[model samples]
Target: MPRTPQPRTAVLASADLSFRTRVREALTGLRWEVQEAQGGAEALAYLEARPCEAMIVDTWLPDLEIQEFLAECEKRHPQTDLIAVDDPGPERGPERTQARSPRRNEVLLALRRGQDADHEPQGDGASWNGMPEMTPVHDRTVVREEIFVRGTAVVEATRPGAEPGPGTVRLPELIGEAPAMLEVSRRIRLVAPRAATVLVQGPTGSGKELVARAIHRLSPRANRRLVALNCAAIPDTLLEAELFGHTRGAFTGAVQGRIGRIEAADGGTLFLDEIGEMPLALQAKLLRFLETGEVQRIGDNDPIRVDVRIVAATHRSLAEMVKAGSFRADLYYRLAVFLIRTPGLGERPEDLPLLVERLLARMAEQAPVRRLSAEAMERLRQHAWPGNVRELQHVLERAAILAAESPEIGAAEIEFGETF
Candidate 1:
């Protein structure tokens, strides 16, 4: 049998005439349905009333701080994929700085792979495909010696449908040499640059948000904001207004006009966490947004424009939900452009020591460094982490606080949970 055609995607962006025109043209070429939002309050209302596979947001809105908007989104609808954008200039401030250069060698390594020489440096002022030349590096010795640093390259230049490298995020302190984690890092590297919708499926506390953040940090849109929303935390009735903004007097509590999450995150990423819990009625609306990048606010006639990318996560089996008719199949197809499954802690037992050590180091920044005993390490490996990394962090934090008097934490200090 022939394969079915894919559903269209929604592109939410700002009302700036030129910007909106450019976005519509770009997405139209990709066969995506485009939606428009004027600002944060307007975008949120539209998203709540209509659903989209993914979204694009701008960081610097006329109203509302982009980070604060993402926080609200995390609290309201967690399953939507959010991409944030910002002015490409240097005025983005501290948050932009932290996210921009997540890993120093990522770009350099990507360029190096295209070179012909094993250790030979590309000539100074070397340019690629008409793009500006990369920063000139003079140290040949360092380049030769550091070429094969511990891990394999997480990304590759193979065409689509090729075997993907490990698709996971790699944090500086996240230990473990497990193949699963390596694969996750590879996926992050591959998808970060492209504007595809990403579906991150994993159990709660499994670092789904962390993976999402890693993608944004490494992506072309890193300088922009990364907005996150949680689907389960917010009530159904209020969810629409929260996602797509409302005009003044649209509803009972309409003291003033409001901008939604979708509009607020234009020009960046919008992360929707815990998407499986989204209500059925909202699913259809979301499907509409994904199909057409236009959003009609509650009691409003005009549709605003916005630009964003979507990265969604969930622990539940959406397939089951689709069968039960709780989730929309069309929406599922749009969001699953690239799916990444995060391995549970139990699946990567070898990483326990590394995880513990890193957590301890982070804690030490606030207090003193503490060590974990062999017995404790063994127990951690043996036990099942149902809550995954989030659970592990909590346990370590508690243990650290309790072991403040001692330099080391033993198995006795560890609180064990039930097996999965």
Candidate 2:
């Protein structure tokens, strides 16, 4: 009797759904079980949850840095065979994915061909572009797919390349083909046409402000002034006066009556940042204004009506704060009429290359063009990025300066620091 073949399990860590799909097609046979992860962080989570014999890291991960992910994968799961699809060419990378498999190259190559074929004008859900189409496959560990409404997209979002489809809204400011970021873009498009309040939630440096700006740009009041105020930045003693305006003699420093940010944004949008830090006392006043559309400047009994749409953002969870009594439940409900979450740098590792490219270009405007060596990029991808995209920009800026003598930033030039 023939001996039974042992079942081998593997993990595919990538933010690209199309890539994930292609891999599924390629590895159809060989009695392999697969686990899927969206980013490096999520990949680690999957690994922690269970062990797989082999793990494949796509050339670009959306969440955690790719180099860092590979390093950490090896360190934590040394027994798990690690495979990385090389940059500049994914076929070879997947070919490396062919490791130890009798028909490894065949499957990986077929996957690559299928991917390249996906780019053609194949009417929706058409054939796998003339490749030796393989049967559909699914992951043993469930995969999370980006939910897109009609006016939306997914991992295959049109970048500089990719066939354009109908109802596709392009947001060049926001880069990253990850599902999380794509969902955000879709939400912005759906809500931009409305005047509803949007509360953006995410960790610090997660581009909450960028999300707000995108919403404002897409709103009906795009031409109107966009007034932004950081509630946490202002002292509690003067937050009220700052928001609602203060009469000339309202306070000692009130040299002259001035309009508040809310009033300043009349007929436009008012962005309230760090709203979770807002005082409980002020929450009542804000709620009243939201209900009545009235703003009363300090020391003035008269209330001025402003037709401003409110868009609030915070790094902390207002829901948790509400339950803890730190935030008003009523106000939280009103402000969060629509919610949008911006993904952190660690969550969108697939965007690292684009971010590195875009950030370097911006730096190039003032300084000489700078490039990052493969190692430098790997260093960046591995980092946890608690500082998020903002930290990414700062790190690149510092690296560019440090590498001033050289045109390319190498791993030695890459530096990491913690910020409170």
Backbone clash numbers for all candidates listed: 93, 12
The per-prediction CA RMSD against the true structure, in angstroms, equals: 17.1, 18.1
lDDT tens digits, residues 76-147, model 2? 887676666543444444332322444345445645653574545554643322222211212231111222
lDDT of 1 by residue, 120-189 (tens): 3335532211211111122211111011111233322222344533433243222455777666655665
**Candidate 2, 15: how far from true, in Å?**
32
- The estimated TM-scores of all candidates read 0.62, 0.61
- Give the C-alpha lDDT of model 1: 0.63
The ten-residue window of minimal lDDT in model 1 covers: 141-150
Tally clashing residue pairs in candidate 2.
12
Judge candidate 2 against the unseen true structure and give its global Cα lDDT, from 0 to 1.
0.72
